[model samples]
Target: MTEPERRLWQIVRAGRLGFKFQRQVVLAPYIADFAARSERLVIEIDGETHGSDSAYDARRTADLEARGYRVLRFTNADVMTNPEGVARTILMALGRDPESPLSPTLSP
Candidate 1:
């Protein structure tokens, strides 16, 4: 993992979102940045290096999805600048009830 990836890994591992999410789950040599097994959420933090391998990423995502995982991708900038929003987006994508305190409202 690069510097930015390591930073996001720390955030997720801290469990600041009050959810039980794990960081750096290694499925062979490829390690997902963050993962919530119960929700089947796999979070990937993309940096400049990702630009060079779009096809590879697509294939990897497809394989993970085929195994019933919901893969969420975010740029390093997004994670560094607005991590709360990223967390909320993940929660919303997992069908967390908007009315619940844990769910952030969708803006118009």
Candidate 2:
């Protein structure tokens, strides 16, 4: 894994968001950066190289969406600089209600 991916993993692994996530998972023809299969959500971390590959990324995201998956993308900088924000966003995507209270501690 790249540095950003490895860093993000530390925050999201082990059902930290109240859902399990798999790293480097294969979803048929495409591989996802991280996926919560049961929730049908895929999180992708894009590096600098991806800036030149928007078309390919779009096609990949479309295919995954076609398969009933919702894709969330983050740039490497976003993950490395603000993993907590990313985690919070993922929780929201997983239907975590911000208005409701959660455990003070993040661990599940």
Candidate 3:
């Protein structure tokens, strides 16, 4: 995993955000960076190189969505610089309350 991937993994793993997420899951031809199968959500951590591949990403996202999954993409910079905000966004996407007492803030 990339550094940002590792960091975000620590925040989201083990049902931390009220859902189970698996890393590097294969959905037929594509491998998702993180997947909470129960919620049908696929999270992708894109690096700087990804800017050149938006078209491919769009197709991949479409394919994933067609396969019944909602895809969320975050840049390495966003994850590294604002993980807490990213986590909150993910929690919102999962339909969970980010302000709930059970929710965890980003660690120092």
Candidate 4:
């Protein structure tokens, strides 16, 4: 896992987001960075490589969506700089109440 992925995993694993997420999970042809299968949600952590592969990523995302999975992509910088915001976004994607105390917030 990348450093950003490792950091996000610290918050995502073990149902901490009100959903269980598995890291580096294989969704047939592609390996998702994090996935909550029950919710049909796949999170992809993209680095510099992704900047040059938007077309491929779009096709992959389309395929996953066709298979009933919603894909969310975040840049490594976003994860590193504001992980709490990422968590909040994930919680919202999972249909959780973002206003809940368990929701993550940016640290002072």
- Top-scoring candidate (lDDT): 3
**lDDT for predicted candidate 2 compared with the true structure:** 0.86
TM-score each candidate.
0.76, 0.91, 0.95, 0.92
**Cα lDDT of model 1 by residue, 2-92, tens digit:** 7666666655554444456787787554688888887788998888799999999999999899888899999988877776676667766
Model 2: residues with Cα > 4 Å off, grouped in runs: 98-100, 103-108
- In model 1, what lDDT does residue 14 have? 47
Error of 1 at 43 (Å): 0.3
Question: 1-108 in candidate 2: lDDT tens per residue?
Answer: 999998878877887667889999999888899999999999999999999999999999999999999999999999888777787788789888634577223422
Q: Please tell me which predicted candidate would have the highest TM-score against the true structure.
A: 3
List residue ranges in candidate 3 displaced over 4 A.
Answer: none
The global Cα lDDT (0 to 1) of model 4 is 0.88
- Between prediction 2 and prediction 3, the one with superior TM-score is 3
Better of 1 and 4 by TM-score: 4
Clashing residue pairs in candidate 1, if any? none
- Candidate 4 clashing pairs? none
Cα lDDT, all candidates: 0.73, 0.86, 0.91, 0.88
**What's the ranking of the predictions by TM-score, best on top?**
3, 4, 2, 1
Range of the 10 consecutive residues with the lowest summed lDDT in candidate 4? 99-108
Give RMSD (Å) of candidate 4 vs. truth: 2.2
TM-score for predicted model 4 compared with the true structure = 0.92
Error of 1 at 8 (Å): 3.5
- Deviation of model 3 at 76, angstroms: 0.2
| Each candidate: RMSD | 4.4, 2.0, 1.2, 2.2
